[model samples]
Target: MPDLATFQREMRKAMVAGGVPSTTLEGAVVSDTLPAERRIRVHQNNYRESLCRALMSLFPVARVFVGEQFIKGVFAKYIAREPPCEAVLSHYGAGLPDFLAEFAPVCQVPYLRDIIRLEWAIHSLQLVEEFGNALSADGTPRLSPNVRLVDSDYPILNLWMAGTGQIPPEAVSLKAGGQCALVTLSGGEVRLAALDSAQRQTALRIEAGEPVEGDSLTMLTEMGAVDFHAG
Candidate 1:
């Protein structure tokens, strides 16, 4: 009889790899009319099913872009290559954007990877349990968590909006160009807003890990940002 540790290791390998030594699970430890390989097959199917469902929830827009058949194919390929490490499914697809980028089949859709990144960000923001105190008394929010506001050239906000169906279908022209965006959480809701020059400067400073005060406001005014309130 294989020890518990060795049995667990072989089971994991088979669960993710679909092929383990048939005798790995052979022993009198457990009763079974079914062979060990057949039992392992059941586990593999369950793993695939759970992983596909998790991916579907995380990347609905990607699923829409690629039909169910294609998505299933991609998911199967990805799962066989990359299995879950953490207990939480939310973190499972963190590398999906990179995976999609190198995937030969989806090379035609260049924007698909970026869209996946946006979806991942949205998922992460939703999962974050604590946020910095950045709102004003009037209910307007401020960007207070370092300088994440001014980071990234990807127009991530628009990309996220487009992916999640928050933007109008007709308005979603991929070639329409990028825009500066402000991302914030308020009253348990995530909000995205366009940023003007001043806000952008302030956001830059915040992102650069600089101190904010009167001087930041002056720079923001020069950039045509009259509103410093968070969105």
Candidate 2:
């Protein structure tokens, strides 16, 4: 009899490589509704499709740029190359922005990479807002986990807003793509506020959990953006 590890090994092979690892599994499956290979393909498709939908949900801006058919094809290859690790589903495609940056097929669509980065930042922040408060006790200034900088050499935030219909599509000029911003959720609202160079660095440092102080932090607090003080 095959051990559990052996069975799992074969299952992985079937799901990923599309073939039986052993004759044992081949003979063991008693399917009345479909052939064994067909059944295995169904399982594989379901697993990949679930992850595909999750990726699109996380990076809707990227989805708009590539369109459904194109994005589906892109993710089919991405899923093959970067299978999810033992993490939550929301974190599965954390490396996708990096993946798309180097993906040869998407090289012409450079904006797609930056858009992926910005969308990933928003998705991550939204998840944090959904799950954690991360505010400081007392009246000390602090930022929730949802606050983070999205630095891009493209107008990725505009593209996102336009794609989501929050702004007119023509309001964002694809030819003039360059901006940076801080993404956060406030009172159940997702906001992407523009940022300057120093402000961008400050946001990055704060998100890194560094104890930030100085002009940038002072300005942010003065602007009422960094005051999480309960009082």
Best by TM-score: 2
lDDT per residue (tens digit) for residues 57-128 in model 2: 787777777788888888888888888886598887778878887789887777888777777777776676
The candidate maximizing lDDT is 2
Error of 2 at 189 (Å): 3.5
Candidate 2, position 188, lDDT: 61
RMSD of candidate 1 to the truth, in angstroms, is 6.1
RMSD of 2: 4.1
| Per-residue lDDT of candidate 1, residues 1-231 (tens digit) | 677898888777767877644465645235479775666677778989889999988888877666788888888889888988888888889888778878999877666676676666656667776444444455332344322242334554565666567876566565655545555544556555667555666666655546565655655433333234444
lDDT of 1 at 28: 25
When superposed on Cα atoms, how far off is each prediction in RMSD? 6.1, 4.1
Score candidate 1 by lDDT. 0.64
